[model samples]
Target chain A: MSVNTTQKKHKFNVIDAVILVVICAVVAAAAFLLGSRNAQSEQNSVTLEYIVEFRTIRDEFVDNINVGVKLVDASKKYSLGDVVAVTSKTATFIGTDFTSGQLVYGDYPDHSDVQITVRSNAVINDSGRYVIDGGYEMSVGATVYARMPDYTGTGYCTQIKEIKD
Target chain B: MSEKNSAAKASGKKLRLNIIDFLIIVVILGAVAGIALRFGVVEKVVTKSSLSSAYVSFLIQDIQDESANYFVAGDSFYSQTHSAEFGVLQSNIQFLPAEAYINNEVGELLKVYKEDRIDVRGVFLCEGIFTDEGFLLNGTSYIAPGSTVHVLSSTIDVTLTVTEIDAVGAES
Candidate 1:
C-alpha cells in the first residue's frame, strides 16, 4: 500500500512538471511570435515620409533643421533618410521637475516643436508598420534619436505615411 | 527499502515542477510586459480613453530682457514628452523684473528685482483631462501646480512652474 501511494505521488509530480513546462513554453512562444511577426517581414519598398517631432530643443537647432539635411538613427546606426520638410511650433512638455511638489504646466523656455519630415525608403508590411533603413521600424509614437550631419536630437516618430507611386 | 529509494531518486531527477519554476515563469511574463510598455508598443493604447479640455497657467522666472521677447501670445505648443498638445498661449502673458533675495551691506537679505533678469507669467488653453491626479495631457501625461516643467516651444525652451489649473468641461 505504501509503495502504491509513493508511486501515485510521483506520477502526480511528473504531471505537474509537464503541465508547468507546457504553460511556460506556450507563454514564452506567444510573446516571441507576436513581437517578431514583423521583424523580418518585407512586402515592398516604397517612398515613406515620416515626421519626427522633437520634444525640447533650442531655437538654434530648430532653425538649423533645414531642408535637404541627412539624418541617421542615433541608436541602431541605421540610415533614417534626408530631410524633406521642417516645420516647428511652440513646444510643450510634462516637466520632469517637481521640486515644488506640485504639477506645473507651461511653455518650455527657449525651445520649440521642430517637426522634421524625413523621406526614406521603407519596407511596407501588410499591417501598415514600415521598416525603415532596412532595420528600424517606423510606427507612430516610436521614440527616435535622429543624428543629423551637424546636429542630433531625440524625438518621437509622430507620423508616418506611404507615398503612392 | 533500497529499491524504493532508487525509485524516489529517479522521480526527483526527472524534473519536477517546484516553487522556483513557477516564480521564474511569472518573472518572465512580467519582464515581457515591462519591455512592451518601455518600448512604446502599447503607448498609444493606453491614451485612447478619457480626454477633455482644460486651462493651465505657468510662471517662468529669471529671463534676460532680450530673451524675454520670445514669449509671444497666440502661439501653440506641442508636447514632446507625450503625444498631446501642450497648450495654446493666451494673451494673459506678463513679464516683470526677476526678484531675488540678496544680502545687503548689513547682512540682511532684502528682496530686490534683478535689473538684467525678468520673470514671465502666462496662461494656456490646453486640451487634456483633469483627474484626481491633476491634469492628464492627452489622458496620459500628468500636470499640476507647483511642479517645475521645462516648457518647449518652436522658439524658446524655458522652465516654468505651474501656477493653476481649471478644467473646462468638468461641470458641463
Candidate 2:
C-alpha cells in the first residue's frame, strides 16, 4: 500500500482571502453608491406651495374648505396637500348669442370660482416638473382633482412656487 | 531537465488551478453579487400615492318619476357588480322625455318621445383617476361618455349610461 500525501485546497488560503476581500470591496462599493443616491434624492426634496384653481364650484362646497384642512385625491387615496388659503369670486359663464352670434358672459348662479393654496413636499424631476409625493405632477395647466374632508372638486394648477427647503 | 523545469513551474503557481477552486470562487462572486443587488434599489420603490375623484353625470332612462327621487343629493351608492361604494349623488336629477327613433317615408329618422318612459340625468361624485383615455374608477372601473354602469344605492338600484364626465370644479 502506498501513502498519499497530496493536500486538497479546501483550506482558507491566501487566494481565498484575497477573493473574499474583493467580494467585500465590491459590496462596499455598491452600498456606497446606493447610499449616495438615496442622499441625493433626499437632498433634492423641497417643500413647495402651489395654487390650484377650482372653477364654477358650488358655493356650498366652498364653505367646507378652510385653512388647515387636509386635501387628498378621493379616488386611489393620494394625499394631495393641506389647504393653506381659500379665496373665491362669483363665477361667470361665457355663451354665444344665437341671433346676433355675439359672445356673452353670464353669472353661474350659486357657483364660485375658488382658488386653493396648498403646501406639499416635492422633488424636482429631471424634466423640471415638480413632482408631488413623487408622482403628482405640479405643472401648470395639469388638471387636478383635490378632495377635502367634506368636499371634492376638479381644478387646474394655475401657479406653483417653492416656498422653502 | 525538462521534467525538473516543469516541476519548478508547477510549484511557482501560488494557488493550484482546480475545478473545485474555480467553482468555489464562482459561488463567492455570485453571493457577493446577490448582496450587492439586495442593497440596491429595492428601498426606492414608491409606496405613496393619493386618490383622484371626478364629477360625472349618468343618464338613467325608462324609469318612473318616483325612481328619480332616489338620487337625491348626499345619497351614496355602489357598483352593482363590485358592490363597492360607487359615488354620492351630488345634485338633483334632471328630466327629459326618452327619445325614440323611427324611420320616415324617405328613410330619414324621426325623433319622438316614447310614451311613459322618462330619462333622468344625475350628477355623481365618483372616485377615479382621470387620464387621457378616460376616468378610471377605484383604479379598476373605467368611466367615460357612453359607458353603461349598473348602480345600487340605499334608496335605488338602476342601470345607467354615462352622458357626461366632468371634474369637480371643472371650468368651462
Tens digit per residue, CA lDDT, model 2, A81-124: 88899899977766556656666666666678989999988878
For model 1, the stretches where C-alpha displacement exceeds 4 angstroms are A1-165, B1-49, B80-84, B169-172
lDDT of 1 at A79: 79
lDDT tens digits, residues B111-145, model 1?
Answer: 57899899888888887665432465666555555
Question: What DockQ does predicted model 2 obtain?
Answer: 0.02
DockQ versus reference, model 1 = 0.02
lDDT of 2 by residue, B1-172 (tens): 6666666667754666665467667767777877656543332232226347677777787777566556678888888865567888876668888765554443333457887677887788887766533466765555555456798888788897765667777836
Displacement of the residue B135 alpha carbon in candidate 1, Å: 1.6
Model 1 lDDT tens row, A36-103: 65464433768888899887665645554668877767566677888999888866644333345444
Candidate 2 is scored at a TM of: 0.47
Candidate 2 residue B31 C-alpha distance from true site, Å: 20
TM of each candidate vs. truth: 0.40, 0.47
